[model samples]
Target: MPYDYKPYAYHRPPGLTAPEPRHKVAIVGAGPIGLAMALELAQHGVPSVIVDDNDVVSVGSRAICWSKRSLEILDRIGIGARCVEKGVTWKVGRTWHRDREVFTFDLLPEDGHKMPAFVNLQQYYVEEYLIEAAQANALIDLRFRNRVKAVEQAADHAVAVIETPDGDYRLEADWLIACDGARSPVRAMLGLDFDGELFEERFLIADIEMAADFPSERWFWFEPTFHPGQSALLHKQPDNIYRIDLQLGWNTDPEEERKPERVIPRIEKVVGHRDFRLDWVSVYTFQCRRLRNFVQGRVIFVGDSAHVVSPFGARGGNGGLGDVDALGWRLAGVVRGEAPEAALAAFDRERQFGADENILNSARSTRFMSPEDGVERLFRDAVLHLANRVDFARPMVNSGRLSRPCVYPLVAPDATGLPEVSRPGAVAPDAPLADGWLLERLGVGFTVLAIGCAAPEVPGARALALPVTPELAARYLGGAGAAVYLIRPDQVVAARWTACGVEEIAAALTASREGRT
Candidate 1:
């Protein structure tokens, strides 16, 4: 079934007639990142106003793969379960060289976590679900068709001149988040440009509605006979939709290649049949680029406005969600006057680290997938040839190193014998508890997780003490009898100790809250 492109109703804002009160935060995009930013802020008791030029969701099935970390962040904002139920879930991926299989990987071999490895849902459906959730939240004021025309930054606040259907209006806010996407006008208003590499390669993305018996696993072929000297990718989405990506050299014209006449025969060769209806077709050339600094004065950038990667790793959307997760609580604190404005520096620093990590990985994958003529091509071909015979070479296969949350480098308290998965600056690993789950207990605030020990009393922090289950012991208390973990508001482990006093825990909590960790 085709998705309904229902437009959101736009009403005249109060600023059209007269000046309105300053908002705590003003978001200038209604895409996934902007909508999720509003919801995440609302979760922290901060109100935000979201404006976008478009009233409808994305036109095509863009950004179909959602990572597990992204789903966890979405669950916090209230749409993860719906996306999981509606999307096709898969954890395994197979990489092939021509007709022979070279390597396969299971992203999530264990079953303790709540979200799966990856969910293949169209960008439109996720936006619809987020829009519904944002509408229900009283703290989020969503204004559709309100495009940002001009932006002015002051010493303490930023103002956006919004052009609406009725008239132009000026909206002021203490912070302006630019989630307007890859070609961000806000970034241009601030005279900022991305600094990175743009690969000279193009790929045809076609979403075809077809009924088939293919398994729900990612399939990537290198130099396949069907495509002939090019790479191809296949994935199954909901509503009998299958996404196909065929690599086209830099010389091919995008406009001519996107035509159905040019796309249908290529897809037919890959699928070996003509029983498919083309849902959406697009030809894209991607780059792994990002801004040097995500924060500039009172204005901040999130999502693609801050960074953009190739479509292969599913990093673009997921990395944007990572920015939302990292910024929401800190920005809320700064707005509420609970924390100094300097705390935002940490958000800027950490997310910059994340964006660099994403760009590095994406660039490497792009080089591997579309290598140059000489030594680069030789390396890729050698790895692929040896991958099938040698176990050591199997890990060299790089079919877009699937997106995973980047562990921020934090200088904080830590102990040696604990598991690396729950180390400082890394997200806390989920474990099954006696009742629900570990992450469920670690709400949207600072949490003191004491495993196999009593939690110490810390002001302004929730403490949870639990007996050691096998999963908890293995993940949190490796070789140690008891451990205490100080978790930040975003669920990243701030500090950990085998045994800690109340004063140590208190000091750690203060550091984490102040973004010192």
Candidate 2:
């Protein structure tokens, strides 16, 4: 069944009648990224006002794949379990060349983590969950139908001119996060544009309601017999909806392709049946682009406003959550006067690194999927042909790299022989403890995870000591008998040591807070 979209009620703003107090943060665009940004800030006791031009959730099953890292981030903000329960969880991906199976990969072969490797929940569901959480939080003031028309940044604050149903009003905030999407009006107001590659290839995305007994695994085909000479992808979502992406060449007319007359036959060819209801259809060109810098004075860009990638890798939405993860705690610290404004530079630095990584992968996948008729095509066909029987060539198949958390390149404390999974600059690996999960105990703050040893007291950081279980030992301790780790508020490892003193742990914590790491 198609989702019923309900409009959120909008009320008159106090700023329409009188000047309002400055907000700690003002986020434009109430999409998944913007709403999640508000909720994440609220979790740190920082209030934010979210404004958007629309009142309803997204119309289609956009951004259906949520990575494990994104799930963990959502869990911290209080919606991970709901997303997991409602989403179609899958980890295995199969890639085929013509009628032959070429490559198969498992994203998560180990256990003990709280979230699955990936979940196929629609973007609208995620937005709805975040909106509900936002409405219940006192720190989040959601202003639906309030559109940001113009933005101006001062030395200490940013101001947005918003047009609402009642009247036009000015909103002031210490920081303005433009969670507004790919065609961000806020970014346009600031006269900034993305710089990267835009491929000539086009793809058709159709969400169809079907009652099929397909496994919840990602299936991709290269020049399949059904959709001859073109690539296709299939993913299962909740509500018996299936997401189908059929690669259409650059010459195909988007308007003509989107019509039901043109879409149904193509979908019928892939599914081998005409018994499907097309729910939503969209045609998009491939793009891998980003802003040179995500932060511009007091107005910062988050999500699609900062970067965009081809949809193949599931990087667009997941990368946005990465921005929220990196920025939320730092922005909260700055708002509460706990950290200097310079701390935001780290958010800008790390997320740019992440965006570049995503763009690189997305671009590579696009090139392979829609190769030109020369060397690119020759190489792609050769790889697919060789992959059918050879183990070495199977790794060369470029269906889509899939999304994973990018480890920030931070120069921090480190120790040899400890597990690389929990090394500095990486997200702390999750493991099972006696009572619950390791991430749940991390508690959205700096943590000293001492395994197989007593935890050292560090100011402004929680200490957790545990006898090493098999999973913990494998993920955190490696071959070492004991290990100590300094975890950042975002659950990223700031430092780790086979053994460390209290003073060293305290210094690492201070450095991480100050963005020195």
Using lDDT, give the best candidate's number: 1
Tell me how far candidate 1 lies from the true structure as C-alpha RMSD in angstroms.
0.8
What tens-digit string does per-residue lDDT give for candidate 2 at 151-263? 99999999999999898999999999999999999989999999999999999999999899999999999999988888999999999999999999999999999999999
TM-score of 1: 0.99
Q: List clash counts for every candidate, in order.
A: 0, 0
- Tell me each candidate's TM-score: 0.99, 0.99
The 0-to-1 C-alpha lDDT of every candidate, in the order given, reads: 0.94, 0.93
Consecutive 10-residue window with the lowest summed lDDT within model 1? 508-517
Candidate 1 local lDDT, 279-318, one digit each (tens): 9999999799999999999999999999999999899999
RMSD in angstroms, all models? 0.8, 0.9
User: Total clashes, candidate 1?
Assistant: 0
Error of 2 at 309 (Å): 0.3
